[model samples]
Target: MDFRGRTVIELGAGTGIVGILAALLGGDVTITDLPMALDQIRENVRRNAAAVAAAAGRARVRALAWGRELSSFPRGYDVVLGADVVYEPRCFPALLATLRHLCGPRSVAFLSCGMRRELGAGRFFDTLLPPHFHVELLRRHDDTDVSLYRLTQQHDDTNVSL
Candidate 1:
C-alpha cells in the first residue's frame, strides 16, 4: 500500500521495527505498546530518525493499553498495524475494541499473527467477523507458521462475507 502522507499506528509495537519500517516507507507512524515497552520502542524510533525524516515521514512512541482509555488516542488513522498481537486470548476483546475505535470508514488494518492453535490465536478471527470487517490473506511464509491479513470495515450497504 502507498504509505506516502499516510498516518499510521502500530499496536503492541514490541520493538518498533514495523513502525520504523513504515516511517521509512513514507508513513507518519505512531508506535504504541504498554508503558513498560515505550523506552525500547523510543530508542528504535530514534535509531531510524534519519531515514524516517528523509522519507518525509515521522515516528513516535506511545503507551496504549487496549480498551482501558480509548479517548486518549487520536482516532481515524489511515492504517493500523500489529504484529503478533493475538497471542493472549484474554486480550482479544480489548484488542478488537481498540481496532474498532481507531479504524474509520476508509481505514485499513494489517495484522500479522502466528497460527498457533495452542495460543488461541485463531479466536481473533472469530471476534473480528461479527463487526462486519472484510478480511483477506495478505501473505504467508512457508518457513514459518505465520501469516498476515488485510482487514477493512465493510460498508453498511454491503452483503459480502469473508
Candidate 2:
C-alpha cells in the first residue's frame, strides 16, 4: 500500500521487519509487541534506525501486550498494521479491542496473516469483524503465506455473522 504520510503502528512486531518496511515506504511507524520482545525489538530498531530516519518520519518501539486491554494506547494513528499476530483464541478479543480503541476518526488497519488452519485464529477475526468495520481484500504476497487485508471504520453490530 501507499504508506506515505501516514501515522502507522504495527502489532506483534516479532522482528520489526514489517515496521522497517513501512518506514521505508514513508510511514511514521510505532512498532509494539509483548514486553518480552523488548530486546529483539530494540535490536531491530537499532539496526534499522538510519534507514527508518532516512524515510523521512519518526519511528518508535513500544511495549504492548496482546491479550491485555489498555485504556489508551501510545497514540492515535491513521493506520494500524500487524503481521503474524493471529494465534490463540484470546488474541481475537484483545486484538479486536486494541484495534477498536486505536482506530482514529478515519483509521485504517492492515493485518497480514498466514492461511494455516492450525493457527485457527483468522477465522475468529473473520467471524467477529464486519459489523464494526469494513474489510477490503488487499494483496496476498507470494513470498510468504501472508495475506494482507484492509480495515476501515464502520459500525459495531454484534449480531452480524462473519
Candidate 3:
C-alpha cells in the first residue's frame, strides 16, 4: 500500500524493521512493542533515522503491551500492521482488543503470519478475527507457509464478542 503521508502503527514490532520500512516509504510510523522490547526497536529506529528523514517520513518507538492502557494510544490510525503476532492464543483477546481500538471505520489492518498449526494460528485466523473484522486473504506464500491478510473494522459493532 501507498504509505506516503499516512499515519501508521505497527504492533508487536520486534526490531522495528517493518515500521522503519513504512517510515522509509513516507509514512508517519509509530513502532510499538512491550517495554522490554523498546530498546531494540529504538536502536533500529536510530539506525534508520537518516533514511527516514530523507524520505520525509517519521519513525518513533513506543512501549505498548496489547490491551493494556488502550486509552493511552490514540485511536484511528490510517493503517495498522502486525507481523507474526498471532502465535500465542492466550494473548488473542488482548490483541483483538488492541486491533479494535486502533482501527476506525476507514482504517485497515495488514497482518502477516507464518501459519504454524502447533501455535494455534488457525484458531485466531479462522474464528477469533472474523467476528470483529472483515477478513480478506491478500496473499499466500506457499513455500514459506506464510499468509498475508487484510482486515477492516466490521460495521456492525454489536456482533463483536470481545
Candidate 4:
C-alpha cells in the first residue's frame, strides 16, 4: 500500500526492519517493542537513518509492553503492523486490548503471523479477533505457513464487547 505521509506504528518490532521499510516508503513510523528489545530496534533504525531521511520519512523507536500504560500512546494511527506476534495464547487478550486501543474507526492493521498449530494461532484469528475487528485475509504464504491479515475496527455496538 501507499505509505507516503501515513502515520504507522509497528507492534512487537524485533529488529524494526518492517517499520524501517515503512519509513523508507515515506511513512512516519513508530517502531515499538518491549523495553529489552529497544536497543536492538534503535540500532537498526540508526543504520537506516540515511535512507529513511532520503525518502522524507521518519522512524522512531519506543518501548511498548502490550496492555500496559497504553494511555501513553496516541490513538488513531493510520496503520498498525505486527509480525509473528500472535503466538502466545496467554497474550491474546492483552494483544487484543492493545490493538483495540491503537486502532480508530478509520485505522487499519496488518498482521503477519507465522502459523504454529501448537500455539493456537487459529483460535486467535477465528475467535478472539472477530469480536473487535473485521478481519480479512490479505495473503497466504503456504511455503512458510505465514498469513497476512488486514483488520479494521468493528464499530457496531453488538460486536464491541471485547
| lDDT ranking of the models | 4, 3, 1, 2
Q: Per-residue CA lDDT of candidate 3, range 74-116, in tens?
A: 8999999999998898999999999999999899999999988
Q: Tell me model 2's lDDT, rounded to 2 decimals.
A: 0.78
Write model 1 residue lDDT over 43-153, tens digit each, in one string.
888888988999898898989999889998878899999999988888888998898889888899999998777977766775554566788878878689798988898
RMSD of 2: 4.6
Q: Kindly list the per-residue Cα lDDT of model 2 for residues 119-160, writing each as its tens digit.
A: 675575577667667877687777766777888878546655
Once fitted onto the true fold, the runs of candidate 4 whose alpha carbons sit more than 4 angstroms away are: 157-162
Candidate 1 collision pairs: none
RMSD values for the candidates in order, in angstroms, are 3.3, 4.6, 3.4, 3.0
lDDT of each: 0.87, 0.78, 0.93, 0.94
- Cα displacement (angstroms), candidate 1, residue 16, comes to 0.1
Please provide, for model 4 over 1-162, each residue's C-alpha lDDT reduced to its tens digit, 9 standing for 90 to 100.
Answer: 789989999999999999999999999999999999999999999999999999999999999999999999999999999999999999999999999999999999999999888999988999999988999998999999999999999888866677
When 2 and 4 are scored with lDDT, the better candidate is 4
Better of 1 and 2 by TM-score: 1
TM-score of each: 0.91, 0.83, 0.94, 0.95
Residue 5 of model 4, lDDT score? 83
TM match of model 3 to true structure? 0.94
The candidate, 3 or 4, that scores higher on TM-score is: 4
